[model samples]
Target: MRLFRSLDYATDADPNWAGSLLADGTLPSFRGGYVGISALRNSDVLTAVSIIAGDVARFPMIVEDKAKETIVPLENVEYLLNTKVNGRLSAYQWRFAMTVNAILTGNSYSRIVRDPLTNEPSMLEFYAPSQTEVDTTDPNHVVYRFTPYNSGYTIVCQQEDVLHWKFFSYDTFTGRSPLLSLGDEIKLQEQGIGTLKSFFGGGLKGSVLKAKGKLSADARKKMREDFERAQSGAASGAPVVVDDTVEYQPLEVDTSVLNLITSNNYSTSQIAKALRVPAYRLAQNSPNQSVKQLSDDYIVNDMPFYFEPITTEAEMKLLDDEQRHKFKIEFDTSKVSGPSVQDVASMKTNGIIVGNEARQKLGMKSIDNPDMNRLESNLNTIWLDQRAAYQAAKAATKGGDAHEGNSHDDNAD
Candidate 1:
């Protein structure tokens, strides 16, 4: 991996030539267009995106040393990701923004800043997907072209100098947004909302007034004004006293008749399906779901798609070959396990995780006691051989007591 990369200031490479470089092949030379953040206007979209991204951001990323079975913290990368990512964003803010960008736009990019003398990473600078482009013309050395926000110039970077996170992707380079395929559903939902707003705003109330015969324009105008005046404000619930020449007929505009409520619910479910989010996560709750069951389903089914991409890309881009062989980077998923008190106690008693490890998951400080670091079965049934020996010793003690009693009885006779 290249530890140091200088920004290429004098390159004449046109930004238009940028393309995505996949491991197997290349994609079309175009910037993966940015989907507007306005998509959050949809309630379901906002909820789905927030639940996934917020949970992701809440989980901490750590580098684990497989050889030593311990965590090795890198102040540059780990601290930046867990505490502060850059000058402008906190760890949570950075993660949330990047995830939102990836989910909405299908790609997120950040430049890795490294120290000149030590050749260690120092900062991670974020770039909007729209501000970054990839040039895959060279199969061996893929290039990144980044235009800084509100800046007039573009900085050309080597593949090693930037971190790219992608969502669901077919070509492995440019990710496909969930909204891309659900365009019709989103449009219909938005239109439905607009219709509701207009219907209520206009105060139509699904009623039409008819005249007995063709009336003059002046008469029609006066009648409409009088009708609106009577229907609004103080006279809203009162009966309208119209002349015999006019008749009122009520049209069916109930939500059930129009299928408005059901249609909106179906659209929301479709949006959730498209995003691979559980419907309950978007406030579409089912009849009888235990919290534990829902939490497990979320972690097992929905979360891997959101978590693995970022961690895998981070491991590849952040760690060098030697470090990667000895260490791995991952999020501490147990934090979001939503385990009950009984479940957590069982884990401890079974020696699945040590005290400090469990405490870390609970966001508590580690105890300094040696017992806290040890993993021991609370039931004293650790190994099969030990259990067998314990049972044998108990039987021998009982047999000895019986023999003693028999000897005492023989002596008395």
Candidate 2:
């Protein structure tokens, strides 16, 4: 484990020797395409990242028993995941933040703090991508160099002490940011957004003023300003007292003409694809698809890419060798794509699940009655064997009791 150092020579030290630019004192632009973390200013990027992170945050990791093939909850892991990760954030907020960092920067790092006596993991302290660097100089013993935000010192630790999640990594050490690859698309989106802002921000409707004769620079400038003022506000309908040299031709403020909206949509779609999120999830119109279809597409196609690595990393790093052999960690996505009401009802009716299990899935309270917990038969909630026994008992009671009553009635008569 490593701790803070003196800041006297920290700034003077060249970060190049530290490996990647992430070791720099300032947050460097990730791959020179977009500003690091500032790329979230683009609405599509923000939306995509939020969707993935939020989905992951909703479900905590579950520990599985390998030999029994069942999920078993570990109290410490459960508390760490469901209650709190460290002093700064709860489990949900921490997970969301880490996921956002991973999606945007292609890498997320967390220092694993262990108990001194037990040597078991006690806490996970998250580090920003900008503050963390991979020291790959030693191929055999790769280590992590972490510089805390706004701090004057750096900490160096072994690979085992840090949990690293990499996305789209060519080198096994660091992951590549998605923005680096989607540079063109992001540029197109930014340009379209700029054009839209100019269109709306400027009071002018983008109409053209034609001058057949060559006008001086000052005259041309004056004419353009006059034309814009005339076309907007109360003066819009007023007749312009321009000489015959100038003619005003009104241009419609049509977004279709500029193709900005179309280009923006295309850019957003491409970004969604790059992030492995559905276009609809980024607020793109999907008139043809239902909400359920879009949700299913997201859960089936995109979630695994974002979630599997995190869970796998947790299983490997959070647990010890002895524990790893018998237990594994997994995200509880059962509720994410759970069965529909009709499916749950059918399962209960057909005895595939008991009433209590059905109630839990449906978010209903469990019944205390023993009969409600019993397996139901396909016919009217009674088991086939129980129904048969019930019918035989009723038939014998009817036969003997009715005969006895008739004999008593005859004797009385």
lDDT of each: 0.73, 0.74
Please provide, for model 2 over 261-343, each residue's C-alpha lDDT reduced to its tens digit, 9 standing for 90 to 100: 65457788888888888877777877598888778777877788877788778877888898888998877655656678899
Score every model by TM-score.
0.77, 0.72
Q: How far does residue 283 in candidate 1 sit from its true spot (Å)? A: 2.3
- Clash count of each predicted structure: 0, 0
Please give, for residues 156-243, the per-residue lDDT of candidate 1 as tens digits: 8898888887778886656656776666777777678777777676545567789988889999899888887777674444566677
Over all chains combined, what TM-score does candidate 1 have? 0.77
Show model 1 residue runs off by greater than 4 Å. 1-34, 67-69, 203-255, 338-413
Best candidate (score: TM-score)? 1
